[model samples]
Target: MGNEYRIALAGNPNTGKSTLFNALTGLRQHTGNWAGKTVSLAQGSVEYKNKTFQFIDLPGTYSLFSNSKDEEVARNYIVFEKPDVTLVVLDATSLERNFNLALQVLEMTKNVIICINLIDIAEKQGIEIKERLLTNRLGVPVIKISARNKIGFPLLLDTIDRIVTGAIECQPLVLQYPDEIEEKIRQIEPHVRAIVGDHVSARWVALRLLDGDESLLDEINRLITLKGAS
Candidate 1:
């Protein structure tokens, strides 16, 4: 058996996320419910360059704010499970809209790769994406591909391999909020860090708290209680 890595596949609905997942996993995948949650996620494993990559297809969500059960499940997995790397798929034709989710994922974790799918279609529509510019702006590797045609799969898999093996480093873009919000985040982040102690992203927890995310607060409290019991 080769070394194994867990990758969380996330994107908005109809971004060809499932198509990419199917392409990578082929018939070696299974669908199951997340622990204690009714939301089901498809999981599969594939071997690349003598390494095993296990991909978990998270529910398609526009935002990570736990507005719905599916969103909650996806957010919790990324925050708590801390996959080795998150591969966020985006529709090349609708790059602007797809960026909402991609940016959210970047805020949560630095280990991320942006996969722009359907590039061929986008080109046909005369939509041009400057890949290098995007990489510079996002501070992460961005690969263009057409999942349906299996175009650029080699580069995609190679990039994933590099990230998982630490051959490539990612410094995800961090958004700057209004001064008032920044001040609040600064105030609460230390307290959150004290409690979570690097178990999760304290800054993100602080943001959620400021947004009055009751679901996240409950989750934090539950984790604290579990830690105390342990």
Candidate 2:
């Protein structure tokens, strides 16, 4: 079978993420709990330009660094399965809080697209996000969409096509930290690189290590070891 691109819909709770997923796939989603876990998983198909995608709706969570099984399920998929794209559905009205999760995904992989949902609500509340500015800052394409009203989806799907086809590169936001922190990232990068796949950015993992995030380190190290064995 030809490759069907896989996408993970992830973001904070109540960002209209489920609404967006429903809107995208309508009633076609295959629902089940994540493997060996109780948290629900919604997988569906969306075809555009004669290309197909398998959308995986991750359980809503504030961040990936959680001990909760819901959070663990979401974190494990992105880190291990390494989906073709991860569409982070964030609320535009609350970018700062939503950004925390987006930053976490950046550490996992570059195949990320930030969907700034609730743009209409933000406008009504007089909160404006300079889409171009945010896109430029993150070095990734930012497609603003009001999922309920179905705005900018055509472009979003087109962007997804380009991403999965490797027609364009996804440049995830790799934020800068203090000089000392940068030194740590540089120190840990080589070790991470030797173990992890080329698809994941080691510098991002390095920062996670400096922050003393054992879950992430252990996860990456384990993935690398598994990849080595195979």
Top candidate on lDDT is 1
What TM-score fits each model? 0.96, 0.88
| Candidate 2, 1-230: lDDT as tens digits | 36678899999999989989999999778987665455678899998877788899988999887568678788888976788899999998889999999988987878889999999999999998888898888878888999999998898999999998889797776678889888888888898787674756678667667777788766666766766799
- Please give, for residues 21-137, the per-residue lDDT of candidate 1 as tens digits: 999899999997777667778999989878999899998999899999889988999998899899999999988899999998998998899999999999999999898999999
C-alpha lDDT values of all predictions: 0.91, 0.84
Strongest candidate by TM-score: 1
Query: What lDDT score goes with residue 11 in model 1?
Result: 94
Model 2 lDDT, residue 57, Cα: 92
> What lDDT score is found at residue 84 in candidate 1?
89
Candidate 1 overall Cα lDDT vs. reference? 0.91
